[model samples]
Every structure is written in C-alpha cells, then in structure tokens.
Target: MSDPSRHPPTQAALGILFLILATAFFAVLDTSVKYVGAFVPVLMAVWFRYMFHAVVVTAVMLPLRGRSLLRTAHPRFQVLRGSLLLAVSAISFVALQYMPVGEFTAIVMITPLVVTLLAALFLRERVSALRWVLVTGGFAGALLVVQPGGNVIGWASLLPLVMVFTYAWFQILTSKMARTEDPMTMHFYTGWVGALLSSLVLPVVWKTIPDAGTFAILCLIGLMGTVGHFLLILAFKRTQASTLTPYLYGQIGFAMFCGWLVFGHVPGQLELIGIAMIVLCGATASWLTARDRRLPVEPPEA
Candidate 1:
C-alpha cells in the first residue's frame, strides 16, 4: 500500500518538465567538464566551473533578489551543504581524469539505491522488498558497466562511486532543508558555498590558468550547471519528486550522445548492454518508488 504520509503530491506541471530538462543540461555540463579535462587537471576544471557559476549566481541574484539574497539565517547548514557539493565536484573532476564522461555518468545512476539504503539504515525508514530488488539490480548493472575484472575498469571507476555516495548524502540534506526554506534561498546558499570552498581549494593545487578557449568552455560549463540546478528547482516546484525522478535516467542517453560527439568515444557492446540494464533497473526503481508512494497503507492488526 502507498504511504500517503511519506509522499507529497506533484507540485506543478512546468516544474516537472524543467527537472527533465535540468537532467539534460547536467549531462551537457558534464561533457564540457570532460572536454576541458583533456587539457587540464580535473580539479582545475572544477575550480573554473564553480568560479564561473558563482559569478552567474551572484549576477543573477543581485538585481532580482538584492541584498536580501545573502540573508541565509542558517549559515551552518549552508556551509555543510556547500561542503558536500565541494566533495562531489572535487571527486568527480578527479575521476574524470581516469575515465570517459559517459562511463562516469553511468556509474552515478546507482545513486537511487544508495539513497534507499541510507534512508533505511540511517533514517530507520522501511524499504520494500521490491525496492531492494531494484537497488540490487541497479548495482549489478553498475558492476557490469564497470566490469572490475575487465579492461574497461580502472581505479578511477571509484570516483563516480564516491560521487554517488556523497551526492546521495547531499540530496538528504536538501530534502531536510526543503521543509524550512524557500527554493531561491536554498539555491543561493548552495552556489555561494560551493563557489567559496572551491575558490579556497583551487589556489593550493594551483596550476597555470586555462587558455582563453578553455576558460570560455569552463564558463559555458558553469552556465549549463547553473541552468541545470535551477531546472531541478523548477521541476520540483511543478511536480512531485517522485514524478521527476524517472527522467534522471535520461542522463545516460545524453551521456552516450555527448561522449560520441565530444570525444569520438563509443561504448562497446557490453557497455551498451550495461546501459540497457541500468535503464531497466532505473525505470523499475522509479516505478516502484512512485508506486509505493501512491499505494494506500493498511492498518496493522486491525
């Protein structure tokens, strides 16, 4: 039976579509990350991305939101949120150095299972048998995609895994914050904090600045990322999280396309099969989650 208490109804129509598009933009942003990573350290790429994102966030927020935008009553939470983002970005860029963008993105699709497991273990929430099955299948698909024993697997495969665990944690934090703050305020803190943390870190590992073309690409990376996040907000605002979650798997397809177009990289038949497994696992998980959320609860021992 669906747990009405556990799930909320879809927010709005536009928000759902925006979230879908947001995932697409995120895939594109990742492609840019890989393209630029070809010439520089992934950390350098991460640094430039956050720096440019900060500028865009600040510029856009200034006139519309004014100084009011800076007023986050919860500084500690804001910092924590940013710190999570920093870790994810840092790990991801580092991982990109060792793997293609598509492979990295493919691995990240396992996050749904991570979130489910974490919620059950840490939050003491009940997980359905069906959901657990989906998580297991998703991970099995991940291993197939990774094929640790195969030539395709490398130490870098671990980066996206790190990204997965951290991102899952980040989403948990966001879920908590969503109850207490406005979306814009949440976005403000998220961008500003990431920008600040990356700024401080970039100088320490500091290599030479990127050339103009590379720098420009980095800026485009920033823009796409910002749009991607904002699209998430839009999607959530219009539809329930459950409604938007399914579209996330679309990133794999986008990742595949981006991989081919940006780097002339093509997945082998096995990876293609892995992608199919991931798609099935992802779809089943989403449907199960949404289905579970929609089912009516039965009173125990009534």
Candidate 2:
C-alpha cells in the first residue's frame, strides 16, 4: 500500500475526492443514526454506536498492534475527547429526530467557524477582520435556518446548536492533543471511552431491538461512524487540511439528497437560502483560516 503520509502536499485534486467520499459516508452514517433513533432509546442508540465502534477498532487493531493498541500517552485528554464526542452524538441524534437531516447538517456545519472564533478568544490567535466577518455571517445564516418562529423551535432546534458548541470544543481538544499523541491511539481511546461511559446508562435505557432489521441498522450506525472517520483521517493524510476543507460542505448536499430520497422532504425557500448562506460563509471562514495560519506541514488528525 502506498503511504499517504509521503504523498506530495499539493494533492488537492485527490484530497477533494477523498473528502467528498468522507462526507458521503458521513451522510450515510447520519442517516443510520436517524433510523436507529426512531426505534431505539436515544441513550441506548448512542451506547450501541460507541460500543460497536470499540468492538470494530479492537477487532482490527489488537492482532496487528497487540496490547499496545490500548496504551495512550494522554489518557485523560483521550477520555475527555471521547466523552465530548459522545455528547455530540447524543444531542445530534435527538435533533435528527425532529429536524430535517439537510437543515441539521447545514446547521452543524457552523462548527469550523465556531472553532475559529473560539480559537481567537481562547487560544488568543490573531484572526483577521475578514475572517471575523465571515464568522458573523455564518451565525447569521444559522439564524435564518433556525428561523425561531418559522417552524423549527423549542428543544429540537437548540440540540444542534449545543452539538455545534460541543463539537467545536472537541476539535480544539483534538488539535491540542494531536501534537503529542498518535492518531490511531487517540482513535482507539475515543471509541473505548465513549463505549465505557455510555455503558453506564445502558442498563437503565437499553431495550431489546425489536427485530433483526433494527439490529442491523444499529450495527450499521457504528460501522459507518468508524468508516466515515477513517476516511476523514485518510483524506487528511493525503492532502493539506486547508485543501480539503471546502469539500466538507458536500455533506449538506448529500444530506439534502438523502432527506429527500429517504424521508421525502425538501427545504423551503428560506431554509434553502439559509443553507446556502451557511455553506458560503463557513467555507470562506475555513479558507481564510487556512490562508492566514498556514496549516502545519504535518497532516491533521480527524
């Protein structure tokens, strides 16, 4: 197998392809999460997702790396990162129950902008004024999507916002820890930590899956999560993070298509406009951040 790490930094074309695949896989993963959410208890669905993630990772890694696969230099941060992602899954899954997948996906796309703004505030990074404008417009786009009184309201809409906030923090933690930890090691711990923590609530919330079909969907959810993330990692290895950032927006289009095909739903005029605004602003912010900071020569871990 060719080592992606040795690939030229300018593989923008291949990176876009890989990123598009990653987003498509993620869209499928979200669809499965939504499917399982319909029949499974939210907590139980999340637990199963992580539990199966841990299972898949362990099954693949233990033989190749032996017990070393379980070791981590930063166990605390690993656990925290895993816990944060579990929160994201739990909240986002609930949002999926009530919101259209495309709109929800578009709203969550604000994560990169939120990360940039948070970096400026917490990391004290000097964000150019243009990037700040982009970030502001991103939020404005999110507001248009939510449209407080238009239709989506109450707890349903807030869930994605919460997911966005937590996901931004998750990315910040990932960036910080990426400096010290192996990506595979971090991936391993993320699965196990989430599985272990979510297992605590399984006893109370666990319900027997009604049939083999639901069982398969639950398994598919876990499988897709792991695979989607794996593809994301591979894409990063092959090309610069900045080069792949724009392609990530492809998820919204995939989500929209999936929503229409599976659920027979389409966004309204305002919602479509909001999704466009969010995509444009978020992509601009991502490009500016990459242009300004010049991402590390080392490939970013997903």
List RMSD in Å for every model shown. Answer: 6.6, 3.1
What RMSD value applies to candidate 2?
Answer: 3.1
Tens digit per residue, CA lDDT, model 2, 1-302: 24454676566567667778778877877777776777889888788778888988888878998878777788888989998988888888888888888888999988878888888898898888877888888888898888876676676878888888898888788878877787778888989988999989899998888999998888877877887777766777677666667777889999889889888989998888889989899887777655554332111111
- Candidate 2 ranges with C-alpha deviation above 4 Å: 1-14, 292-302
TM-score of each: 0.86, 0.92
Error of 2 at 232 (Å): 1.0
The sequence of per-residue lDDT tens digits that candidate 1 reaches over residues 231-268 is 76556545554555667677777777888898898978
How good is model 1 by TM-score? Answer: 0.86
Query: What range of 10 consecutive residues in model 1 has the weakest lDDT sum?
Result: 293-302
lDDT of all predictions: 0.70, 0.79
